[model samples]
Target: MRVLIWKDGENHLIFNMLPGSGPDYNSVVELSLGQALIAGGGFSSWTYRSGFDVSLPVYSPMAAQLDSQQIAVQDRPWVVISSQINIHPEYTQELAHLAQEHSELLVLEACPSMQSSNYSMRCRGDEVYHYPQVLKRAKFCLVIRGARLGQPSLMDAMAAGCIPVMCADSLVMPFEDVIDWKRAAIFILEENLNSLMEVLSSVSDEHVSEMQVQGSWLYQSYFSSINAVTQTTLEILNDRVFAQRARTFEDWNLPPNPLAARSPLFLQLTAPRSQGFTAVILTYDRVESLFLLIQKLAKVPSLNKILIVWNNQRKSPPHSSMIPKIDKPLKIIKTTANKLSNRFYPYEEIETEAILTIDDDILMLTADELEFGYEVWREFPDRIVGFPSRTHVWDNVTMHWKYESEWTNQISMVLTGAAFHHKYWSYLYTTAMPGNIKEWVDQHMNCEDIAMNFLVANVTQKAPIKVTPRKKFKCPECTNTEMLSADLNHMMERSQCIDRFSAIYGYMPLQTVEFRADPVLYKDTFPEKLKRFNDIGSL
Candidate 1:
């Protein structure tokens, strides 16, 4: 009858009786099956018959002249090996003598080998032999179970209190966790056989005692055949379930199996992009210019913000309703005539690289000319420059704006009545004068823009301001133009209003700055701000 018992679900694979006991009954019949199963992913299982008559095993301690408790030497030591190792008879005799000389132990297993006639069991002195009896008394068992058939002998040695010393290169026997290999086993690789004597000579008595305690622990824990069978079963079954679940989940979540699937695009256009310039149209009751400037600014690409500072006490602006769609921030500052400067001045608080200062009286710059002004500032960051009037149609050649330079020479202050790059207030704050020229403009004059040009040029080392052609339609305020033409007296009065500042600062020019490579390089250029617009195009 054949009996197959599985202990732990799928781990321990053991087989009991073979067929009829004939001449074909080989001692290694079940061993061959165990080997095949081990090679095919299964744990080892040995079988012993329940009712077979067994010889009584003897475990008597061998008689010796030396004390068993005390090691042969103090620090010097030795190892015990079974007689199964392949060594010549003459070499074995030599091994015995050397062990005695070094005070090392050579506790040999007293079994006669079934093969190989080269070595005999005969040895030197009082043969300090290791039989089954000696094994129970010994502290260590050096097991080298390399052959297919001799593992049972090694286990038998382990059952007797002798700690087995198998090489690390050998297959891990079952119940390995129970053995404290680090303490009890002295593992040597096959390649280091030539130096085995040196290893044996270095073993100590304390080391041997530690090994004995560890060996006893291993016997109680791992070497039990029943426990080994139970542990192996769980390992095989858990591995199979985990692999199956992993494959099933991965298949469910895998992306659309179509060969040409496209990935979603995640492009972001978050930042505010501009040609990076701003236009501010200044107004005082003249909503026409404000409307016209907004219309033209709307068409200018890359304008960041448009601001309309309307100096009208009686009215609020209809800017959002009147202007075309633009992708820049729009704001309006409206105030009475008396609070004109105060209300509009706060808009200057808007932080930017440059500011466009516009005059309500005249308009000449076109949409194209306004953008070109920004390009000029970006390119030539060192000096202030204004747009030039377009086609001589809006030209102000008849108007002469004269002022004196620092050296007292008369220079024209006239620029095309359009736009100018604004300067940072910090430049004025750090100045020896301690204020933007505008602060003093309302005090001593109405020409705040003109005074600022002089202050910037003076402090910045005579950098010339360049004027470009304006694209907006240039027109003068009717009230101011009529007054100037009607009376030389009124014209002189307005001119005298700015004369006090001129006397204090020197002959001020309308155009004191020249275009440097880039006005921004002057290090004090403010950002251009555009807050609001109107539908009227350029006025």
Candidate 2:
């Protein structure tokens, strides 16, 4: 990427892109590069240049065009703003009469070419000055898209709270991603120049104000500082990588019969051709939170089956617990304290389109939230999965969890254990769980989920962590208590235990790995956090 700094002399900065990394990181790298350019005497001589005037910070051609006396004074109260500078002989008389009849804002027609008594004049094109300054002084800008599409002009106009009366089809528009255009700018078709007067007249101050707010919001959301482009770039440079992989449930010997006769579970629960996914929660003693999770998970629109793999708890059944038994088949798999059963049994039982491995202590999540996740997973299957962080509330906290959308370009390493693709679990099962139980069991420690993620990261050289958009969840048991006290203590303990165990034997087989130590928090304080807490008190 080449950046040209326009000062008294032109300074060029050439940036070389690294192999394997694409334009995704360009925005982030530019921040550092811009600082370097500034520090290298790039703007040293620019302080006292020819056209420098600090007081006249904002330069609006509209203001200049509207305040000059180059057009004929008009009788009507309305003002007609035009982009044309050349006052041709044919239209000069009409323009003068119109100005004489109403307020007219005309572009400067160079010397005595077309003089009028009733108008204000301003020059167009290059003499208008830079965008940031120009936009601040103008009520509205006549945007000729030839300047730059999706460039800083439109953004600046929006930022400065100026209304942009622009041509519909321009050289460049920031229509690259998604934007609600009606809420942003007033787009005029060149062919509809006759109606332009009417359009301008119809625009109310209130409408303009609303549009300004909407435009500003859009700009800040997608184009401002600390945006997705910036975040994604930072992730790449920081050695955090995210990738999405897709596979049919059939590929993993899971359910949702693409072939009709295969799954009894699907046949009983869903309509023919109805797509579904199962979430098999792996749990032990956290019964209260587990029941809460079941209630939340029940709200997910696409969930076909809910299976609770109760490690070494044959005495408990799904009906006896706080979790209700719905029309969908809910089962509790009881097993002895065999380490392998805790790790593998849930995966084995979740024979559906996709198997979401949730911890027992989650008590956050409604049907709509899960549906959002499913939709995101469908759209960006290559990017794995997404969910909002369940850590903190937005009102009390300063920053938000940035990853709660159907699509987000922002990348973070903090949400690995919360939500992920079912394919990832399968990958771990195949690659990391190939050996006998004794070989990998030592790999299991406190916070096995996080440890597994680290294991996957080491093996794959890609970050297994990400932020889920707005959906937040935490342990339900943590309510009315300091989050960092008992809740954080349990979490930290498990994490430290995992670290200690990994330090000892290095790697072990899946069967011997103990997943019981992984502490699942059960709160849904944040929208992204789906609180799935089992009724521990009842159990």
Candidate with the greatest TM-score versus the true structure: 1
Q: Lowest-scoring 10 consecutive residues by lDDT in candidate 1?
A: 51-60
Can you write out model 1's per-residue Cα lDDT over 216-330, one digit (the tens) per residue? Answer: 4444343334344344333333434575433232232233335432312121222123436555566665666666666666777757777776766676766577755566687
lDDT value for model 1? 0.43
TM-score of 1: 0.35
Runs in model 2 deviating more than 4 A are: 1-274, 318-323, 338-346, 380-417, 430-445, 455-460, 464-472, 477-539
Predicted candidate 2 versus true structure: per-residue lDDT over 6-93, tens digit per residue: 3432332322222112323121224333323111101112221211111010112233222211111122221333333332344444
Superposition error at 29 for model 2 (Å) = 54
lDDT of 2: 0.42
Candidate 2: C-alpha RMSD to true structure equals 21.8
What local lDDT score does residue 373 receive in model 1, on the 0 to 100 scale? Answer: 61
